[model samples]
Target chain A: MALRREEILESARVLFNRWGTAHVSANRIASDAGVSPGNLYYWFPNKAAIIRALFAEWSAASTGVALAGLADSGDPGDALREFVHAAERQPAATARYAFFPRELFALLHADPELAAAYRRNFEAGVDAITTIAQAGIDAGLLIDPAPRANLRDVVVTAWIASECAPAFLEVIAEEPASGRGSGLAGAILRSLLTDEGAKALDERKGARGHEHRGIRAG
Target chain B: MALRREEILESARVLFNRWGTAHVSANRIASDAGVSPGNLYYWFPNKAAIIRALFAEWSAASTGVALAGLADSGDPGDALREFVHAAERQPAATARYAFFPRELFALLHADPELAAAYRRNFEAGVDAITTIAQAGIDAGLLIDPAPRANLRDVVVTAWIASECAPAFLEVIAEEPASGRGSGLAGAILRSLLTDEGAKALDERKGARGHEHRGIRAG
Candidate 1:
């Protein structure tokens, strides 16, 4: 029964990613999972329930991945570089839930429960980002990117850019296949770093390039 | 007949902006407009048609207002300030079609025709922004914010920031009354400006402050 439930969720994710949540029906998800409609209904009372479950799963998974291994880094530039590296390493992490960002507002509007959960997660993410920026400022490795707005504003702006840039880039602008990297987000956040911090980030990038070649040769 | 058509369109805009496009039905739109169902159908064959009509109207209106009066400004700083001012001057211009950005991907996926039209308009907007940035570079008024990325990349990042920031700010982060201005977008774009350009922008801002005070005194 547990395996069947997992199958249903997996099918729903694939279908939602391909055809969007609105276009894909509950029955379609069940059939795609090769499960009977009754079985699917037994697991999830309705489509919204399935969506809520998926969001919960994604949210839980992302919280660990978003700022992993960067908390203890004393150097602001190292923290920023790892932040971008973590993002680049996990394109599939976000891409798996591609439909979410694309229809974020619509999904939130449809399910108030999901909206509440998402709001909590989003606020937490913002706070996490703000803390990182504040640390950088205290260390004098980061400067205020926007002189008028506060640090929270800069964090929110960077948060929004990182969150929405992928969808806009792939869907609207139709940029050529460089969609996997979090370069734009990195660029925005790095703008806040002072010259010394920027040098650290650039040097890290050079090291990463060498590591990639070494791996390829090995 | 024309007046009735306009009424239906206006009602759809209001309801879609409030309740979202997915929740609002054609009958509800007709009822809101005080028009018969048949009359609404006579004007728009389906909900998609109404959405398309609204999008067309918005695209036309935004094109005119987007870069208004900034094209002729010889100073890059002046152009940048005017660009932000144009955005600040017309909150309603984008807010009127608030649902469009929120549900952009869903709407596009549901209707191929609308998606094609939107893509065309979006590409045009990017091109227009790129031209402005290029001019700034030519005049040495702006430097590339992202040294690794090209000018178009910078513009695209700024465009995405401007396009998606409002929705994310209001819906996700729940910021206060400051959602009206395009400050995040202005900040991202202004990052590209050189010291000379930045000075011009700051001076203009100071001047605008004096003007606001004068107007209040009057």
Candidate 2:
């Protein structure tokens, strides 16, 4: 029963990501999952329940592994890379939830419960970035070049740049979401880096050069 | 008859922008416009027709007026401001079409004809930005700091930054769309400016200081 539930969710995610939630129906999800409508309903009472379950998995994946261990590293470059890496790792991780980012407002409008949950997650994401920026400032690894560069504004800029990247990639750049917005987000964040921060980033990049050798697009 | 048509379109735009197209119906539009469902059907036939008319009006407005005179400005800062001004002018102009940007993909997925039209407009916008950036580079007003800063990529960045600003403003920042995304978009573009470009921008800002004095958030 647990395995069947997972299969239903997996099918729904693929269909929703491909055709969007509006176009997909429960029967489609059930058939794609190789289950009868009754079996699918047994697992998820309705489409909304399936969506909520998917969103839960997405929220957990987003918060779990990406920003996990970098906070203790105390190096702003690593922290920044870790932030960019979250985007770089999208294909392997968050890309499964691609439909969420694109359909964010629509989904929120449809589900108040999801909207409240997402707002809390959004605030937490902002706070996490703020913490990282403050640490960077303390370590002399990040500096504000603009006279009125509020850290909050900077964080917001970073947030928009990163969060909106996948949609940007797909729509504007006509690219796949594999690299996500890593290059753009990293460039925007790098603008905030001090000379020392830049040097540290260069050294780190050199060390990881072999790993990211051909992925210059990122 | 033409006046009534405009009223119906105007009413539909407001309702769609406020609540999204999915939630707004033809009957509601006719009621809002103080017309009968029969009259609305006479004017638009269906909700899809209403959306197409709005999209047409939006495309014309977007391609007109704002980028109209700036290409010949010769000053990159002026050119850039004109680009940014397009967003600044949103509350008075394009903000009526706010629903389109936020619901872009969803709308496109629902209507292939609109998708094709949008892709064409998207290309034109990108080309316009590329031309401006190239001119700036030639005139020593813009510089590519990164080794691999392709003009197309920079244009793409600016395009994403500006085009996605309204959604970013409304969704993430929880702000109204009056200023659109001038600040963040301008900052990203400014990161690509040469020293000459920066000085020119400051002088222009000083000259127009009173005009934009309190609206610095843009």
Worst 10 residues of 1 chain A by lDDT: A209-218
Docking class of 2: acceptable
- For each candidate, what's the DockQ? 0.37, 0.25
TM-scores, one per candidate: 0.83, 0.77
Interface root-mean-square deviation of model 1 in angstroms is 3.2
- For model 1 chain B, where is the 10-residue window of minimal lDDT? B209-218
Please list the C-alpha lDDT of all candidates, in the order they appear: 0.70, 0.67
Clashes of 2: 1
Say which candidate scores most in TM-score.
Answer: 1
For model 1, which pairs clash? none
True contacts kept of each: 0.26, 0.10
Using lDDT as the measure, which candidate wins? 1
lDDT, model 1, position B54:
98
Instruction: Summarize candidate 2's per-residue lDDT along B75-116 as a digit string, tens digits.
Output: 555676556555445445656798987887677767877777
